[model samples]
Target: MSGRIAHLADVRGGYALEADAVVVGSGAGGAMAAANLARAGMDVVVVEAGPQVRPDDMTRDGPAFLSKYYWEGGLRMLLGSGAYPTMSGRCLGGSTVVNSAIFFRLPDWVRQAWIDEAGLSGLAGPELDAAYDRIFTRLKVAPTPMHVMGRKNLVTRDVLDRVGVPNKPLPRAVDGCIGSGDCLTGCRQGAKQSVDRSVLPEAVDHGARVMTCSQVERILFEDGRAVGVEGDVVDLDGWQKVGRFSVRAPRVFLAAGALHTPVLMQRSGVRLGGRVGGTFAAHISGLALGILPDDVRPWEGATQGWGGFSPEVQGLKFEALWGPTALIAAEWGGLGRDLSQMLQDVRRAAMVVMVYRAKTKGSVRATRSGMPDARLWIPPEEIHVVARQVHKLTAAFLDMGAEYVFTGVKGLPDRIRTIDEASGLLSNRLRGRHMTMTANHVFCSCPMDARADHGVVDPEGRVHGVPGLWISDASVFPSPSAVNPQATVMALSDLISRRAADLSLLDA
Candidate 1:
């Protein structure tokens, strides 16, 4: 039961297809859902808005990769008092294609909280653990090997060890990482087990069809039930709409991501009293760069190889980060001469980044042009907390013999050589406007809850008051996950899709 991948050229000038189920967006959630449904003997079609970028086509060119895979060329921002930049992949595999392959299971505390507070009993007990075991086995999730964790990551580990923090080599969804430091781009070595390389391939083997460059604009409804979907077939390079495509199916899974799922629901005229696009949230991140005594060759190691934790800050954690020179240099803001020096110094620099669960909730609304307009207002106190995380990371690096630390807070000096300087710069009143941060882990837009008034979807991910349409993405999270959400997304999708199949819900 082998299936094939259909590119834009394959469906030019109007195409029509039929499937037992259609899953929109072929990232972690969609891919996992498709695989589970297909394995259950349902004919699945996965429609993705982006191109099918192969591993052979991946390159080290940062800008080129960003333009090809990232939404809005990696410059989409959450609009508010302070514009917080965010990145999500727009390619066949979605964000997993462009993100570091770190994988984390749903933390017990987060899961228990969701069950107790949101009444998400479906996520309770051993079912999710079983799903996680399957996904980890399928993706070969394992601790990153020390050999590929070059000096950049090892140095961060050393600092954590000296500080007596809980640190370990990150468990990543990679088979054989060569330490190319190109995870933010794409894995040329084809080692990163992004759904495109793992779950989607299994889905295809189970006869699930994949269509790239097909943007689902609207959910086709019949008698208040999702009957199918239709949208434009976009050109891979220019992104121009060259044709139209439609998929008819009994069930539809909206896994178009947190940012786009709500917009798609609104565009389809699915009314839920503003629940579809409300209550958006994201993980807030801040990074500290340290210049070491010797050239670390930061770009030669695993992009994100290690993680550190401290008991003092419950939801705060640190990760070692490295990437392209130009992208990393963007942290140090300046013109001509200053920027050039930072670029040259990047060879000896590495980053320790902190990501924390945000207490602030935002909203996503669809613009008239059919784009997602997302806004998250971070309170001044949250910014100060993030700055404290940044200060802690900077102090740790400085203590570990870093020549100097780059605290990217706007009001702070570019280079801080002492813990006292870092502390003074990150005082209690630091505002959100002073920090340059980015969030890729965006979710909770279409949260799941037992009560209809609280969320757009039910605890099982079925859209409230919408028949035959379900959501299988991070958008269904009732709250922000304290850890990376890819594994959680995939695991939940697998659970939901399998349960739906087992219960014969597609025909209901």
Candidate 2:
């Protein structure tokens, strides 16, 4: 029997419910945890702050979708050396719904580092491998097929091949991707296997109840032990609090991502000596456009189907990027005529992006309005690192016989036509102020460590000093993953949640 789904309309004056466990944030981690616990026969309640949006309900309208489903209406940014946008979704299934569906397994070197340096011994054995297998199978993870890769991705593959750079099709959590090229807005075709469409429904089939439009404010405590959560039931249309709600449970799981998870912990009075919101890290990314002489119709391809890593570059990787025409044009800064011409020439545009793993840590705090205010400092050296990345991609395009490469670096020429020009342009003048940087994979705010004082959570994801409270999200990463975090997040959530279920049974 499928459990009930309660929306704002179903919630009256308020709601007071009880469950064996309550999971927050319905994204990758939360949905996975809920499914595991529910299958274990525990009564689970999944509370999400955003509305439940089905695939058919999704649209290609980027602005409208961002306003409704994204945090801070897609305007949330990191503040420090430069203002960099952090795109995180606020809808049910969270970022998995808006992400490009790319799946990269946790690197073996990163795993070894976790065991040796981070003291996460349990993450090494068959249990972690089993978790990866189950998730990969469940999501139907595979490489994007050639037919659906479209001309843009194919051209990128060709360019990398010609440059003697090893590249391949990106593995994605998708079943029947049509390459509509709007994965960021939302997958209207239901092809992308986001958690809401896969694991969350499986959880409901296991008799786990899902409560939408339910924003959890804080963890309820009884003598320093977590007992439940309390917050507002919000109206989705206006985003106004329509009623108050509470859920009493023996266990509470936090999967609210990196930015908001720290704020949530602080609000619940579970601050671990101000470490809850510190040590924030991210994979900072920037892009340069390759204006091809031939028409590639950038909008027709898979959003990001091909990518490569350079043997020379240690901390950065490259990918083919595309989106709505407006999003692509926004990368090129100009006046009316220039903008209009760029729009007209959109078909001749192919974008190459560089994602750099940030070395410096950042911080996240709750704003006066109770939203997450995140800040990260990109040092001048990292600025040069990003500039080097830009130089590489620009050079690749010039070698591919591109009509011109458009790099939006403030100090450089609008069109870089030669390798020498790009080298001289990006030699030393690039500063944080010259580029608009962004990151979607933000993590480590509530990092986990074996030592109690080193991080907010213990190795098992239990809050160091707060029993009955656990975090099963990227917030618990000891450090940056140096790749996309969704796969690692789900694997860790699976390990932690299954343990939680076993503990619940032992107590019973």
Candidate 3:
């Protein structure tokens, strides 16, 4: 599977590449679309804002990976009642490269809601099922084996079973995982099936050209139609401008993730009214920490292996999460001597994260410099819901034989010794500023809807009032997907590519 890849940092002068189709990203959506389009005999070129970090170059150091691959050096902040840190990858494979390898089909209920509320048709039928099947087979999605499950995972499963809560092993997109417990830092063992290691290679095999360090700053329009894109090539080391480049094509697809896609559209002067970057949403999450009696070594096995939805709390999902020693220490919540003592028990620490389907809506506005400034507002009712879920999670940890639990709230007690103690502290209404909240799954900026007033794109992903322009990313979701969105993003992109192929645009 040999293909051509250009490292723009090595180029000295301005350049231009011509193609039948130009994709402005190389992540899950862009990679899948490029692969399918090239396989259909279209000359495709993928322009990526980040440098290419090959599997061999991947490392196990958490901070190092975040510094190299994360957007804004992993310092992206969501401004609102409280400042919340948001993370998104900025590499050849995009967020999929730095995410936990979790895979889930778009739930049937979510599909139906799109059809009913957003006027999206054909998505609740065979079309979506077929797309899921194709992606499942390609990524070798499977559940983590018991042998590979770490102590933290086993504890979570046991506690859920004892408490009469339904639980199961999480499905992951991997082939030969050795479980270094560093999926977020990038799979150093090359076992996790990220797009850079999977579909992107297939696209390249089909003759799609990939240009790393090439940021598409604007879309090239001619006579009210998108014809190509232009941007500057930056040095991979210092991120300084090295040269300028452009790609001319008959068609262009925006596959950048939710945060950047809308910004790109605004910078390109493609106005789909105010809906282009409105109605932003995410799965707001709460973090809980537990102290175990024995050494669990949370960082030794599958990073996130056991999780399930709580029947007691609708729209709340519980999952296990493990981080590096440094991260664990920071979240341990103590100063000086107390923190030093907690660090000694870091090896025995385990964490459970609760993700709630938030009802609050947000927005993303492009700054004058073309960077995204995201503002998220969580209502009072939603804050209470998250607080209640956090209390339940803390109790579950105690029931699992943990010594004490730490609720990740800013102005609360550092540790809880019993369920009664947790109940007392959580009785007070939690506000957005006091609760430590963050989101990994973001969606619904440039949504797909039948009505032009409701969204920016139609059901087929074609942008309204613009021909030869399409958006196939998380940004096209009409609302927040209650689960992880990587698989859904890939499936939707595949559907968009197939539709584009049927249009005969490439034959022009």
What lDDT score goes with residue 333 in model 3?
57
Score candidate 1 by TM-score against the native.
0.96
Per-residue C-alpha lDDT of model 3 across residues 1-508, encoded as one tens digit per residue: 3457777645536579899999999999999899889988899999998887766656666667777788887778887757787898888899888888799887777878889998988786677778888888889999988878889888777756654568899999988888788888788888889999999988899899899888778999999999999998877577788889999999999998888889998888875777888768888888778888889888888989998887876667778888566556645657877777776667788887878888877898889877888878888778777787777777777887788888778666677888877774465566788877667788898999999777899999999989999999999998877888999999889889988887332221
Q: Which whole-number lDDT from 0 to 100 does residue 376 have in model 3?
A: 83
lDDT value, candidate 3, whole model: 0.83
Candidates in order, TM-scores: namely 0.96, 0.96, 0.95
- How much lDDT does each candidate structure score? 0.85, 0.83, 0.83
Question: Across residues 236-331, which tens digit of lDDT does each residue of candidate 1 receive?
Answer: 567788898999999999999999999999999975998888789988888888888889988888999998766676666788988776676666
Q: lDDT score, residue 136, model 1?
A: 88
> Sorted by TM-score, highest first, which candidate order results?
1, 2, 3
Model 2 is weakest, by summed lDDT over 10 consecutive residues, at 499-508
Residue 385 displacement in candidate 1 (angstroms): 1.9
Of the candidates numbered 2 and 3, which has the greater lDDT value? Answer: 2
- What is the alpha-carbon lDDT of model 1 when measured against the actual structure? 0.85
Clashing pairs for model 3 are: none
In model 1, which runs have C-alpha deviations exceeding 4 angstroms?
Answer: 503-508
Alpha-carbon error at 382 in model 3, in Å?
1.4
